[model samples]
Target: MRYWLLGALMVTAGASANTSLFNLLNTGDRVNPVAMMERVETDHPGYIADFELDVQDGELRYEFDVINADENTLTELTFRATDGTLILQRNSKLEADDHDELEAVKLLDRKQLRFSELVRMASEQHEGKLMGAQLEHDLGISYLEFKMVDENGKRKHAFDIQKLKPLPMLQWER
Candidate 1:
């Protein structure tokens, strides 16, 4: 019975040894997603709209979408999972929308309240680590929405891009 149990455990460990990057983080591996996100965001200096861990061409990679403060540029960065080295960088020009995202960005820039500023505020106000952030337009108004996690739990916060005031906490469904 002891040998059988040992053999089963070894098989389980072997099965999980080749798990993907997403599973490694989910299973409480050494790498922290928040820290990785912060590193990429700090190095890139833009609004981190989205991120994902996936295997491309048989290699694991972390993909991030960052939009510049002026809302005129969008950059996609991909990093290698093993060493966190940047493998790919692609920049594209964003078209001006009818709602004029650039105009809102310009107004925020005048007040020195860019996307990076909002990320700083979110980290401070929440008194926790930021997981991710995105700039969104609602009803012709721009808002900075962010998610954070600490001892309490995960929470979402939003700030009015124009006024730089914190909005009401969003009621999140588990």
Candidate 2:
């Protein structure tokens, strides 16, 4: 009987947490996550690998994990809940990839087009909902890989990072 009562209380508490989050969304205390992501991408340009909407320092905020265009770095960006103002931007290095690709990216100049700019061009031409993106060097060529969702499911877009030109869709060997 004690075990059963404890389990019931736990479930009730879980439901209350969900209700509070829902109420916050409905009452305009927080912005929609999807819209927030879109705005962030438009301004910063990176793959959003994760997101969290929670209270920080007693104030609500949205946190996002961004894999930058270089594909060798990760950035954590936190934004205010009420106005979508960026509160913080933190960066970290990624682990090494294939030797050849790693060497190629390292050898390339830093004057190439910005990652956000490449994404904007690809989005304009592809006409789909931008899902995520990353920079990669496949077979000694550096490219920006973007994933998009449309009526036909997901598709990949690869663009030349140096020239800022779109490349053919990669056919992955499944």
Candidate 3:
């Protein structure tokens, strides 16, 4: 029941290793990631468990794992990043005991910064493109993780938005 890292959980579920941050725009009109997230959350109506913006199947995509405590299920949704079109959806039923995930969501709810606010702050940092963003927890503490790439190179960073702190820099083995 304890998650060592979100990326680990993802890998076990057959997620790709090509998670390095990159430009989401590819041959179509520029799609705003924040807008895609908002629209996906609205259409799916669940607590975000994991969210990612990365290139998948040779195209940019926004992938989400949304948890519905009421139904005790987690839905994985993938949308085309260039046009905000739903490309894939899969729902996995959760164990009855795992409904406690609401508690994890509440932990993030108590944070000082709202998700959108923190995302913008992360996007504006150091002239890099924000490739992915998600809430990650460790030992009951929750924070937002941002995967980015800039003139330097790919970077993975954790921001304690709850405390309004910057770059706690997590060491995820890639």
Give the count of colliding residue pairs in each prediction. Answer: 0, 0, 0
Question: lDDT of model 2 at residue 170?
Answer: 66
lDDT of 3 by residue, 1-174 (tens): 457687688765432233233323323575787777667667875667567775656777788777776677788898887778888999889665444444555555565334556667756764566667776656555666777665445567776645656655563423
Q: Is candidate 1 or candidate 3 better by lDDT?
A: 3
Task: Please provide, for model 1 over 8-106, each residue's C-alpha lDDT reduced to its tens digit, 9 standing for 90 to 100.
Answer: 998666545433322444443334445666787678765566555656786666677766755468788888766688889999876555234444555
Clashing pairs in 3: none
TM-score of candidate 2 versus the correct structure, residues matched by position: 0.52
> lDDT value for candidate 1?
0.62
The alpha-carbon RMSD values of the candidates against the true structure, listed in the order shown, are 9.0, 9.7, 8.5
Clashing pairs in 2: none
Q: Candidate 2's residue-wise lDDT over 37-104, tens digit each?
A: 67876776545544566676667787876665466776789999788889999987755543333432
Better of 2 and 3 by lDDT: 3
lDDT of 2: 0.62
Alpha-carbon shift of residue 123 in model 2 (angstroms): 19
Taking all chains together, each candidate's TM-score versus the true structure is 0.54, 0.52, 0.69
TM accuracy, model 1: 0.54
